[model samples]
Target: MPVTSVEKDLNTLSMTIVADFASPLQRLWDAYADPRQISKFWGPVEWPATFVRHDMATGGRSHYYMTGPNGERSDGYWEFTAVNAPHSFEVNDGFANEDGTPNDMMPSMKMKFEFEETANGSRMTNTATFGSVEQLQQLIEMGMEEGTRSAMSQIDAVLEDLATFAAGKGTELQILSDTQVRITRVIRGTAPQVWDAHNEPELMKRWLLGPDGWTMPVCEVAQEPGEQYRQEWENTKTKERFGFEGELLESAAPYRSVTTEKMIGMEGPSTQNELTFTPVDGGTLLTLVITYPDVATRDMVLATGMTDGMETSYLRLENEVLASAE
Candidate 1:
């Protein structure tokens, strides 16, 4: 996750993980195949995870990404290998284009998952082989496996919770929580310009929201607590409007604004939104995070194509932010 503009001076560890769970082979297989199932145990409990497209079949291809607790992103490709169901499958994977063409520059690897019925339940064996021995060794030296195992433990816990939830077992959504979303992004713009792009109400309307027709109707934002922002979201094609009344959770001028969003006609747990700006050469790196209180609500928002909407908002912000590079 991106440390907010408040923690501008602190360092955060961005980690990648892999894990296996003990469940029925078909159950394990379904988690790898279904987007909704993937969303349930996809990440660090606070963030959101959603699939872009998935084709699980022999020689078929897929692609998906995850957004961080703070709206950071990471996505990769889906390659299918040996796809006999309830048995074994493998893939040559990496961040890829919609067509499943891998990003050649990024580290790509081979992943083989094996599922077998165990006396207690089932065993899933995952092996990720990096292309180079150096890379593999490098990951090992950095304790990659340990982190992967921890994340997997989280996955296992959630799976158990899901089982309970499925069997009419619990009320609280806490039983299942995993890291959600992978992050991928970069920013380019002077710090001041970027800050303006995020904080100025009218400015945000132009690039971040769109023309007045689809833009936020009333945006009231304060860079500090006890403040509020009256922002409205409208559908460009359908004229559907969603309203958000938010209290400034935390505000650091020209750096960040964190808010608690309560959207009209939507209930459950309210959503928390945060935006941060960091100065980079010739620009400021902007990070946006959306956190949901429960996995079910998070899943619902993700299913609504919230990630795509957020991406569009960020791109617009970048265009405006970059205009002031000097």
Candidate 2:
């Protein structure tokens, strides 16, 4: 209903759809920037999406999958080529394999999304350019138009539910698959500040302690890729101590980081952790995606009160570290 027009230009081998929404331009832009909000309506009603990774920056990539009614799944990916923020962005969109690699057998397209503020609300222009006429016709035959319409129709509900994704919601855990889990929390601080808090030893020791009785004794942060980092925490009263060490695999300053983590002194497969910080309406949306060695390891980690402890640490970060900065 929000769609005003859907045009197919055979000469240019492109398809364009323009839709109007009853929300501010920033709100509409944020819907796409935040993975949690975008996943809610990125697929057809029957095929809900789960975005395991979303980095809204140039050269960044997003990985998501849509699940069908009968448990079928279709994976997709987007490589951001240009990101102008709140107005327009361009990406190379394509189908992906189960391992999150591009499916070259399927046609990929150059897609651009433009947003603007209208008198009533906002408008979004989505244009996808195919390599050839045959490719465009192929996607059209694959129910591309119908699927997009269904996806856009569900965005109204997500736009109106503003408070759900706002700040102070605490740490949220989402199981993306048997091996992957995503933890999200809106920290009341800027992305740079939040990133620094995690990277700086002094700042981390001030807030990374889980509970009131715990104290961080050692806080060694990895400054760059291939660098090893270690952190140790102790129960102040009981004198119990434990630690974790990891080598940084990737780093993008205030935006994203990937690392391999293992409990120090333990012998087992390590987990891969991907962290991303995105600026939102309230503050920074900190997302951590952890891939365990297996389902058993995933479930075991969750059963250890990991989420609750994370929430406590995040709260301390807001109150002690960020609040002091303000």
Best by lDDT: 2
Off by over 4 Å in 2: none
* lDDT against the true structure, each candidate: 0.56, 0.93
Stretch of 10 with least lDDT, candidate 2: 162-171
Q: Candidate 2 residues 1-326, lDDT tens each?
A: 68889999999899999999999998999899988899999999999999989999888899999999999999999999998887999999999998778999998899999999999999999999999988898999999999999999999999999888767678999888899999999999998999999899999999998878988889889897999999999998899999999999999988899999999999999999999998777788899999999999999999998989899999999988899999
Q: Write the per-residue lDDT of candidate 1 for residues 1-326, one digit (tens) a residue.
A: 11111111112221222233456656566556544455555444544455544445566555566566677776668677766665777887776553346777666667777777767566666667676666566656754454344335455554555453241221111112232332223345654676776678878777766443485666776766987667777777787887777688866556556688877667565677655554422234444455668777767766675545556665666655454444
TM-scores of all models? Answer: 0.42, 0.96
Over the full model, what C-alpha lDDT does candidate 2 score relative to the true structure? Answer: 0.93
The 10 consecutive residues of candidate 1 with the worst lDDT sum are: 1-10
Model 1 CA deviation exceeding 4 Å by range: 1-184, 210-213, 235-238, 324-326
